[model samples]
Target: SLQRALWVRNVTGCKNIHLSSKLLLEDFPTDFLRAVTCQVCDHLLADPVQSPCRHLFCRTCILKYIRALGQRCPLCTFPCAPSDLVTPAKAFLGVLQSLLLRCPREDCREAVRLESFGSHCRGHQEADEEGDGGQGQTFNSYLPVNKGG
Candidate 1:
């Protein structure tokens, strides 16, 4: 009787359907468990990040996906700047690090260290321009003076 009641509730999509106290505790449908799972890609969240529009996805999972598409929010179409995108913090990373793997980018051989993981994944490199210019000289020094008009 309890099992049949749960089956009916699930099929009808009724949220407020009554269940006996014992049945409520015991015979909750497995479908409810599956329903709350992330719809983007069906996996348990590792360091979930909620977008401004209230969509949640794993930090590494969603960032990598967005980066491929030029850093746009997958669900809400919100524009995410390259600098605004970031990795999870230390506490969150601690929980998810083992479960969440690094981006599979071939050139990114790094394994996602906690502190510098974000910069690493983004492949942020400082431009090497310190040596570009020869010893500094004023612009006037490079120009020839014309005394005769």
Candidate 2:
């Protein structure tokens, strides 16, 4: 009856079998977390978009790269177009937004949500640009992707 009642799979193809406890950020491995990171900027993803070739990137990063280089997926160098990109599914986004990151500031160990990480780390953006590599912390609940295309 349980099997007949429901089935779920994460975007990465991991089957969702347990219903009692939700997976926490601490449960994932470093490699799993790395897989979700944006290849271009090497930060936890912001406004993540998937290329036709199945590689992910921060939307802004991909757009900037494409505008400067050419229409291509940065990771695989597959020919890509602006129109060929799509934001992750809401379920996927929800999972991403749930990861926790500590504030990059040495003084602040406060954890931040993934969805608001950009704003939380805005103060360090300049320093990051100056080669200091800003660190920042993570979400929100929204269902825009599942409502339509």
Candidate 3:
């Protein structure tokens, strides 16, 4: 349930700030997780980077934000340069990948690992196009059944 809630928040970019108890605050501090979450996307860190002010964000989210609203830290309004963002430590990425998220596709709600999500989502798209009939859309011929007298 916690994973589903988290998935909904991330995919929909909803500001609903409820975190289920199953997430275990001891294992993941609420504040720390919230800090790493990308404010623009409301998703767990992806290619995380840290501002000079130590604010964390997904690399793309921050870049887009910077491009849209000058070079300033979104949280503190401190001036920020492109070079001011430093890649976050590997441990931070590891923790991010460990968070369980559901597929963004409305039809597929399977829990997907963050690291493999992109490829996993692509597979779903490809599979849908293939359908049960494959690319040729041909059905196999059924053998005739023998009737018992």
Cα lDDT, model 3, residue 145: 11
lDDT of 2 by residue, 13-120 (tens): 112111111223355676776656665655456567899998887666677677767899867999988899887778878988777755545666566666555555
Q: Report the error of model 2 at residue 7, Å.
A: 44
**Model 3, runs deviating above 4 Å:** 1-29, 104-108, 132-149
Model 3 scores what on Cα lDDT? 0.57
Q: Give each model's whole-structure lDDT.
A: 0.40, 0.56, 0.57
lDDT of 2 at 2: 45
Q: What lDDT score goes with residue 89 in model 2?
A: 77
Candidate 2 wrongly placed segments (more than 4 Å): 1-28, 105-108, 118-149
**Cα-based RMSD of candidate 2:** 14.4
Question: What tens digits encode model 1's per-residue C-alpha lDDT throughout 61-111?
Answer: 455566556666766788765455454455644543333233333444444
Per candidate, the number of residue pairs that clash is 0, 3, 0
Pairs that clash in candidate 1? none
Question: Could you tell me every candidate's TM-score relative to the true structure?
Answer: 0.32, 0.56, 0.60
